[model samples]
Target: MATGAESGRRLRVGLLGTGGVASKYAALYGEYPRSLLVALHDPFDPGAGELAARFGGRVAASVEDLIASDIDAVVISTPNPLHLAQASAALKAGRHVLLQKPMTVTLAQAEELERVAEDSGKVLALYMNSLDNPVFRDLRRMITEGVLGKVGSINCKLANGMGHVWRNRPANFWRGSRAAVGGGSFAMLACHYLNLAQWLLDQPIIRTTAIGTNLMCDHIEGDDLMSAIVEFAGGELGVIEAAWCVKGEQMSLHGSAGSFAYIDNSVVTMKADSPFIGEAIRYETPGTRVVLDGLLAPAMSDWTNPYNQHRCFVDAMLDGTPVPMPAGKGVQDMRVLDAAYRSSAGAVHVAVHVAIHVADDGAVAEAVA
Candidate 1:
């Protein structure tokens, strides 16, 4: 362990925003031995004192101060557009960063962040803990073990009812702001699944089609129901559907040789010729207990488990384990999202182009660092 003057057993960390997602990271930090919450920063929170009291962290008056602190990393859970600026600050500060998904509101910002991450030689990660999830791990293993041959098609579906939290509610709801929060519920809520489809399949989206609307929530300018169809380079296709208005959750996966799904986290339905889909098989593969409890549990619950992601960050930073989500993939998701947005507005399919860049020093970077 490094000394207290140098970090000891705990990696000092900071938070840029204390929203729903940030709270998940904070909760996770509480459980990880490799990290400690040293500072908290949220410009709009009136309950900073209470938050600081619970977390035993200093309340930063600004993001700049948080960056300047003695933290080795930061969990940036700020809103959409703010991600670009906040993440850039953390990276430039020479701290590793774990950013909320969708990297940034635009491809350009995501690309820029990727560059900075390489330049700084810091681990810039996306909170895409799902990639390290039990279901995906199991899925990947099954696919690798030849349980699902060829993966001809995968339909990735997600749905959740956002509830009527925006009706004259607390002052903290920024779901309706596009500039601050970026796209509506889809970008914030469902973009992860879009990313999951690509990552879990080990492919990028080649083409995409999207349709969404602002029908239900008048509180913000974002859409309530988000849907998309993407084709992968492997000649495989996937469909992603998410609705902020959906009351129950469901995910179904279909491959050439099998099919599986879980509904409301209660029932599991699967059919595979490879015999790995039976009652004897557990979704939590033997080696992934921490990931199962930390990332999968919280994601399965509406509340995502406390510190799996942060701990994952620590494992990567200290032990050099391969992290599930890299900063570059975050940028790729944003590119697909950008194509989806353009597809919706034009009522036509758009080609998805995720620009993968290599820095002058030969370090590879994604558009969103």
Candidate 2:
């Protein structure tokens, strides 16, 4: 079997949505030389046809039509409720899957998707695009590699003023419905930071104490503000906040040897007393802006950047390499989100357990984390 790159064949891609995030990816796939955006499907979104036209693909009549068409991969950017079904269908149809974040609405659904991916032996990468940033990558490296030795705690906040819009959104708007999106700001946004904090520490989030309320958005069926205290498997503490009623982005890590912090997700500053760095250092990605949208907001304007996750997704598919952002990482984030929701509802702490199994080949084949 010849890899797509080896054979000099562009991988055909089917896009499953045409919303903002989907449009960003469509632009990327249009520019990526190794993958062609060959088709797109979105029953509720009329812009699907326009997106296909702009990206050089045809309008797929339905998801089934898209999967059965001549496409080797599927990019799923649908609502949270539809993720499991759409991804399962695509993977079962012998198409690689690139699923957008917050994996699924429930833990069972996430685990089921993971199982489906495992059995199919197809790529099931998650679109936690921030992992591709050199700043974040360096932060994770510094922490895990002991430059910030034995991080004792992490504090992160990801919020935006989207609740104000959700309050007046039509009932058909999927994001305002709790059942449709699992949760408001937390599920929609927090999963990224939760995954990032865990990735930085290289530890599993083991417990959560949370409080959530619809303090700002009266009509939405989910909490607009949420704050959670989480515990890592290695006893590190995390304070995470996600709100649709506010606007901010920041994260800080405190460790035995030094500390690391970033504000607006652009200016990264770290100080270490270790030999790795005896002084303070600051790093910034120029031309980035503070946007109401999540991390991918900056990348949309420059998708062709070498560090773009879309490039990684295409490269992995063409080269037959491991997924850069595996589904297991998303599963772990979902576990933490699940525990947070449960903890808020119960007004108590909830314990989380993650079962990850490594195959003899050293790949993480299955995980319910």
Weakest 10 consecutive residues of candidate 2 by summed lDDT: 285-294
**lDDT per residue as tens, model 1, 1-369:** 544335546778887887555665565565455567788888776665566677668888788999999888888877777888888878888999888787888888889989999998888998875644455556666767766566777665565666355666655566667665567777876677878777667889889888988767666566778788888877887777766666666566676666666555445566666655432245433212111112223442222333356666666776655666898788888888888878877885555777899889999977732
Which segments of model 2 are wrong by more than 4 Å? 274-298, 301-303, 349-369
Whole-structure CA lDDT of model 1: 0.70
Q: What is the lDDT of residue 113 in candidate 2?
A: 96
**Candidate 1 to native Cα RMSD, angstroms:** 13.1
What TM-score does each of the candidates earn?
A: 0.80, 0.85
Clash pairs detected, candidate 2: none
Candidate 1 C-alpha error for residue 198, in Å: 1.3
